[model samples]
Target: MPHTDTPPSGHATDLALLLTLSTLWGASYTFIRIGVETIPPLTFIAARTLIAATLLLLWMRSRNVRMPRDRRVWMRFGVQALLNSVVPFTLIAWAERSVGASLATILNSTSPVMVFVATAFITRHEPVSLRKLIGVIAGFVGTCLVIGPSALDGLGGQLVPQLAIVAATACYAGAAIYGRSFKGLHPAAPATGSLLVGALVLTPASLLVDHPWALQPSVRSLMALVALAAFSTALAFAIYFRLIQTLGAIGTTAQAYLRVPIGVAIGVVFLGESLPSSAWIGLASVVVGVAAMSMPGSAIQVRRV
Candidate 1:
């Protein structure tokens, strides 16, 4: 059914949701770091997606909304699941094995940059304004600063995992763009369907490679896994789809800028993590860049019903 109501032209509500989403997603890096210590990456992601899918399914049932029956929609869900959940979740988990939660979050902040690039170069879905272009470049430079000079020196050895994080962000960028197709669908529908597909795709791989049934995970790890699935995945996607419907891809992805600071703070407070002076400078740069990118522009107008 086509939506009858107009989407809000004002961004205040979307901004609040964006902040909440960033906080949840920011904390996810910490949970991922904790969970991966006991569970293999593939197994961990499989469980997370499955748990999220179950929760979303239950929510849908409560709302009396049926899953989409169209095969084409399901196929799109499959692709979205691969890009948005399975691939990025696995890569981030794998990267966190070597990368600190703070650093991983910082690296993951590149998603908006990738989104800008994709939108300008490939999708052409939106025009590239001078401010947005500058903002993207500034954000990338800030990201490099966040990694600091010492980390750069060791970049050669950690190149694969670092690149893996970058690749994961790229997948997120792609997923954000692809997800626009679901704008007309109920928000919960695409999130639920994508998670279901992700779970199905990874279950076999996790079972074959990790034999999760035979493994013993700690209670702490179990708690982290639950939080990762419930708060970060299920609830996060619900808000994510809503933001996408109202904010468009670039605006929604702008949350990546906020995630780094929030993630770093979570790491520092809860995990007792610390960063160098350069990282602080880089963090400020990213915040400024994101603000610049998020400034009201002609290209950012959302379509109201």
Candidate 2:
């Protein structure tokens, strides 16, 4: 899956895995929509993280992966939990409640642009270039298009939700930058560690704020929650980290451009939602922008080892 100048056959297989990852992840929004109907948002998120954390812990134990004994590394894991899991997980769930899955995933595609912008400020050594800036502008325009004209129906009413999605993207960007600290840790160790922290932080909040014990979720919703936990959270991370290792970050993020279509497909097929023509246009713009930002040699000098 590593990116190569000569273009190996693994490129094709990596593309296939990326497509599959997008499909699985895109379907998550629908599952969230269905599951949230029966479970409170906080409860749903907390439960999913807990289940995923438990599974990851068990897997790590089976693999003989030792937890980081250093408090600094554990603190880094906590930061990762916040930026990667807690904040974005809550924001996207909240946004999905209002914007629906297709649009939400489109919004999520803005991560690359967000990362570019963040890198401009966060890493002084790697400033944003004019081309990257154009991609950022195009990504925002595409986001606006996806939201459609009716987005302004109320006086600044749509601002919060739109901003929430943006905040989610910011969280992802921050996670990507912050996760550089974990480059030394085994992938599963950090992955499991952060999920544990996420569960610890979120569970008490879910209990105190939502009181999920008092309200019962339907069986269908429970199943959806389990699927989201097992497939979307745990399995997705497994595949994602593997892809990141095998293909590198740029190559893995190339898959972001593909997520929009798969998101739309799952939204239409399962949720019976249709997108506006403008949304499709927006998606096209996003694809172009992401492709620009992710082009080999545009930023990183990735090499297959």
Candidate 2 lDDT by residue in tens digits, 109-146:
66766666556655532434565556566655665565
Lowest lDDT 10-mer window, candidate 1? 1-10
lDDT of 1 at 178: 92
How far out, in Å, is residue 285 in model 2?
5.1
What lDDT score belongs to each candidate, Candidate 1 first?
A: 0.82, 0.69
The numbered model that scores best in TM-score is 1
lDDT of 1 by residue, 1-305 (tens): 43322245467777788889989987888788889889889999999999999999998888777787999999999999988999999999998898754456657877887888788777877656767766777776776676565645544467789889989989999999998888677788889999999999999999999999999999889999999999999999988987877777877887887776676666578869787688888888877776666666565432222
Count steric clashes of candidate 1.
Answer: 0
Please list the residue runs of candidate 2 whose C-alpha ends up more than 4 Å from where it truly belongs after superposition: 1-17, 124-156, 242-256, 268-295, 298-305
